[model samples]
Target: MFKRNKTRRRRSSRQRGPVARAFFFLVKAGVWFVVLSVGWVLLYKVVPVPITATMLMDPNGHTKDWTPLSRIDRNMVDAAIAGEDGKFCSHHGFDTGAIEKAIAHNQRVDRRGRGHIRGGSTISQQTAKNVFLWQGGGYVRKAFEAWFTVLIENIWGKRRIMEVYLNIAQTGIGTYGAEAGAQRYYRKGAAKLSSIEAARIAAVLPLPDERAVNGATGFTRRHGNTIAARIGVVRRDGLDACIYR
Candidate 1:
């Protein structure tokens, strides 16, 4: 009987070994994920991001010149906020209102079989994507984007988020960042960009490789003007209070 009991205990221990190992492995992975995510966020908060997947994939190669938030003109900030995310400062990471609107619009277009239409990604989401993830449209990529967005919003804060966005966003085909955009397009520093110039640059953000910032015309010109007009509205409504302060 004792021998039988000992044999049963040994069998139970063998059965539990794999489960215990798996549990420990999962715990270690979770801890590492948190540590690495927070570490990267904190590192980029001060150090200029050297490269990103977008920059690498661009045929023109990376051409980024990092500029601090204080160095970049307020007009550029206003224009970016107005054009890309008017409610940036108000929302935490995700903009549910915009997401709902986008979903409704996409559904309408889909019903007509007009293909995918419109994107409601806010500046925070864009920053999260541009900085951490690759460019694509799939559930997997989007899930990771959302995860990173939450991480940055909580770990990096609003100001750091804006700062990184301004510094890493692809402005032109080869150019990246506000400084590079301002220099390449306007032959001036980012801090010296006028409201109109800034708006023109901001207009190209949706399609940086396709849009022309130097000789603004047609759609770019009109969009720039619209964004320029909305800048004041954003300011007055305190939509940029999070970073402006």
Candidate 2:
């Protein structure tokens, strides 16, 4: 009886407390997340991304052609910087100033009923979210987006990130990438895009389903024209130097 009691005491002593068990579980999970995320980023650094969650989930179906950065026109690259992220070449991962401005704009818009939502996401953040995450916003998704943004910024660098972003981002109702957008809109290849053509495509990027790349009107046309003009300024000011360099 004493031996049985001694054995029971030893077994109970070996068992972990609830707090200890939870701590160990979280530690294990964190380690696995780090390992797997690093591996995924490393894999994509060398291998072209085959597809993304956004592509698979698009209800309108999708078209894509993976045009290498070298094949894509310089105009397209400049348009993307001008139309989307003006400071793409300078920021690390997050753009705090843009984020702060977006937050303030959103707060002000919220009190005014219906209004356009301003976004502060950088190209890196967009690429990370588009490649590794689903559409829509939530704290959990935002957390994951931040995690992957850091991973890509560290692993892929600016050129690769921009390359992947241009290829993966939704450019129309069913079109994905500059190559597909160019073909669908103008019946031309991405490599042959002029500044105006590229800017129109870039203007379509923010709201691909709604914006018309070919005969854009209203905000889309105005935005495209603005971006088209800025393409030269982008080159002149070297705003897109990182990817070009």
In angstroms, how far off is 17's CA in candidate 2?
1.3
- Backbone N/Cα/C clashes per model: 0, 0
Q: Tell me the whole-model lDDT of each prediction, alpha carbons only.
A: 0.89, 0.92
**What are the models' TM-scores?**
0.88, 0.94
Give lDDT tens digits, candidate 1, residues 138-241: 99999889988998898889888999999999898988999999999888899998888999999999988888987778888999999989888887888888
Candidate 2: stretches off by over 4 Å: 1-14
- Tens-digit lDDT track of model 2 for 63-181: 99998899999999999999889999898999999999999999999999778999999999999999988999999999999999999998899999989988998899989999999
Clashing pairs in 1: none
Whole-model alpha-carbon lDDT for candidate 1 = 0.89
Winning model by TM-score: 2
